[model samples]
Target chain A: MAGITIESITKSFAGVTAVDNVSLTIEDGEFMVLLGPSGCGKTTLLRLIAGFDLPDSGRIAIGDRDVTDSPPGRRDIAMVFQSYALFPHLRVSDNIAFGLRMHHVGKDEVTSRVREAAELMGIEALLNRYPTQLSGGQRQRVAVARALVMRPSVILMDEPLSNLDALLRLQMRAELKHLLQDIKTTTVYVTHDQVEALSMGDRTAVMRDGAVLQCASPMEVYDRPGDIFVATFIGNPPMNIVRAVARDSVVKVEGVEVALPEASNLPAGTEVSIGIRAENIEVHTEALDGALPATVAVIEPLGSHLLLTLAVGAESIKASVRTDFAVKRGDPLWLELRQGSVRLLGSANQSGPSD
Target chain B: MSAAIRRPRRRATPQRQLAYAAAGLITAFMLFPLYLIAVAALQPRTAVFDYPRALYPSPFSIESMAFFLNATGILPALGRSLVIGVMTVVLALALGCPAGYAVARYRFAGRDLVQLLIVSVRAFPILILAIPLAVTFINWNLYDSVLSVALVHTVMALPLTILLAASVFLRVPSELEEAAMSMGTSRFGAVWRIVLPLSRQGLGAAALFAFVLSWNEVFAAAVLTVRNPTLPAQIVGALGQSPLPFRFAGGLALTLPALVFIFFMRPYLFSAFGQARS
Candidate 1:
């Protein structure tokens, strides 16, 4: 029910920093996702926020309270672990009632809340069954139901859908978003899945090497990546980084020069790279105006379209074309970059174009 | 390739039959000594000495058992052994469960060293330590007491108990406890509500081991006590002087309790030994 303010919360193990000097402010009821690949410290950050692990330095606050020193129980928080981690010995009903019992809620209220939570999860029939008796999906629901019953100020989930199958994960992902939205509890979800982060989070904080590289709205992150890493990491088949050189008001991309009038003040002879998304390029069978000639290298078929890996000069770029468009490997085609799709991924010393 | 994915067996296969026969042979080999002891204990005193000793308890009589039970210091020693075994089980569990949990759950300084030391405690023979322990017990006025023998037995059984309990605790993932703690339960509360229940059967197996260890231990019991010797010590002390039937009867008396204990504890023992169905 409260916003979480994480202020330079740093934690390390054995001389390795798991959560670096990271600062973030999540507004009340916001679904903030800590997205990253394996070993990128997303789970470590979530653990710190949950009060399971203390930071070596810096502070964390939920609402107005500085809960940096508190244990998980004292922080008014609930967590759904990646493994579901349901009590194997207890029935679904008892597992849901466990937190209420720990917090010393009344008997009647515990019973009512357990029933309500079970019903909400569509698992009222599973109340009598132990966790071992339940399938992976059922166990996931029970784990979620267990946390939701607590109704803590903040709900922390560490890849809660990672254990389920693909279809179930997708279904649960959508259902969980709606469920959390209705509850309006400030939630911090940790995940490595880019699609999940893009689809679910109010704001996605993409992290790498224990530090957040970018934190922005999913669309903002998708359309305008802050750095080369985000540009490549966020997209499927990823954004193609082709070699380019800035020349006054124009950038020369391989043999083809494209007009980038926004860089009119750019000094000549400065080398740069342009990141173009796979879907951002339009493919033409015949030679067309404002299109660069390319040879198709690889074709992978999707249900509705084919992802074409095209060799444009020395660089390979991906372009998704409709299945009916009719293209083959080794065939020569022309590609036109969509407006605003080409992004300048600049070097450390130069201010090429990207802010 | 898929001739029959899972066909119902009409009868035991040849290989399975051979395996069953081998298993039955091993079982008989293991249980024959106990059967012999039982038969000797049940036979009349004169019949116990008969050559090609009775395979069955024919001309059945409790004469030797009666004599063994009535022997001076035997019943008291049996009682003392039972008490000490019970005490060892309790102490090993009380101390070992937490120690095991700590070893399994925590990453403190010298944790690996602690585990090494625990495992090494069983490397040397307890026989060498018994006299020194007896001396220390005498100085502390704990000598010749049931508690002294039980303490020694606890030391003897503890490493096994701790190692077994730690493995048991490891099976109940630490995340379940962390999840409980994250949901308002304190660490201790989480352990009680989550960990203890999950590991209860494994701990039961550990208790059975500790009790059997205490029940059979003779050297420390003999060294630590004179008047209040355990059943094993008493039987060993009397066996040399007592007649053959009395020895057989004493053997039965000592082995019977542990066998009955293992019988009751078979479920936990089976699970701990990994015969448990998922």
Candidate 2:
């Protein structure tokens, strides 16, 4: 319902910068996910946007109104905290109506709005129960219902699905997608799970070390990472990187030749690192043209597929192959790296991993 | 892993046996004097002076009780004590609960110093407080009144109540208050609607403590008031001239109200003390 703009925001606690000069624009009615590893400042950024935290220096505007110093109550935004934060003393109906009551809405309007939100969350039967009596998922629904009852223009969620089991997380993911689509409120969700980000976000912003590395559609972030940090943090079974140096049409990895993409415009003899996703590497019976010969260091069966940890010279890389493959530790294998998927990183900027 | 299913076989060791024995001895030691007072209170006046105090009084009579209940000035003393206790509880709760909330919620400068002051207030002997209060009361023409006694008792009870209640309120999740604020409630409204309801058990316990402190206090009561003395001050005032039955009966009368209140509020006491410690 409303767009949020954050400009040059930074937050520090006891001289330790938790969120650096981060700026982002969230479109109206968009479902955005801030995806990062733990302690990457995604949650901090969300809290700043929701007005739970004050930025050391920044301007925050919601729907063209500068809300930098406004208290959370005046921001017209709702947040579902990680702990669900349901008022244990209040019944589910009262919890949903709390925002309304604070604004002095009449009893009849409170009840009607509470009922509408409860029905929207399919928690109509649970209105009379206290938070302690509800299951984790039920309490979470109540938290969501409480946030939604106010019809806030923006709803911020901090790892709302982290406490659920795998199956429940999947179910909630689909439910949340449908729910947000129907309400169309500008929602900003934060999570450490790549799967959740990819599945839920209209656009996913990958962050690390107090900065947003990249913000794009999930597929774009995966396929065209802005930097080395986004390249490694956005995909499952993480992308594998091996140090290499380019020289006259060939890239050398530990004195062995590796192919380069023709479209890659890096200068010749540039010291770089080559990145490849596990799924992009194909296994073959024998060494073929442009394929690297490697030995299987380990094989992990994942019911549907086998994860082969392959030893390419001194470095190891993982490849997802069919579980039916007759592969074992110490077995010789041929790995074909998908040419288009190879990401080359310049060596001069080598530092620590972003996340 | 199946071995985990087996129940542990605990043998009685000398150390464990000694610990149980010590606990039983301590409990009996604490209750024995109260039991003796109860026996003396129920006996006839003649039975009280008979040497070798009665472990149990036979044909218990309420005559001493009726005597105290009907005595010209005794009823007024009892009324004064009740008034003082109620006033002390109310005043202490009003001032201390909010002070406690401030100490627990804010991190302003000198907060630790304030906390240290409250802790030290509990340790200062009440006798020291009585000396200064006596001079202040006499100078102000406030001597021998329930108001003077209630003010002194509040001084005695305020620190303890605030410390305990503040700890109780601190256990309440700040996240809940934040949630309320984000839901459009101001800071004051959040505390009023959410924090206060959750902390009622603690506040009640603090009130009960304030009442008991005022109800049983004697030194300050004696120092501050005479003709309008509280029950404890009256008991102490009549000590030399009083008979055994009268002494025991007065003690029983003074303690019974609080004992009954405690019994009625027993369920909340555990949660209150637990919250304080946690």
Please provide, for model 1 over A157-222, each residue's C-alpha lDDT reduced to its tens digit, 9 standing for 90 to 100: 999999999999999999999999999999999998999999999999999889998999998888
For model 1 chain A, give the 10-residue run with minimal summed lDDT.
A346-355
- To one decimal, what is the Cα RMSD in angstroms of model 2 from the true structure? 4.4
Candidate 1 accuracy as lDDT: 0.89
**Candidate 1, B105: how far from true, in Å?**
1.8
Off by over 4 Å in 1: A264-266, A348-355, B1-18
Give the Å error, residue B45, model 1.
0.7
lDDT of 2 by residue, B150-238 (tens): 99889889998898779878978988998999989888888888888888778888888899889989888888886788888888888
TM-score for candidate 1: 0.94
Per-model TM-score on C-alpha atoms: 0.94, 0.92
Cα DockQ of the candidate 1 complex: 0.50
Score candidate 2 by DockQ. 0.46
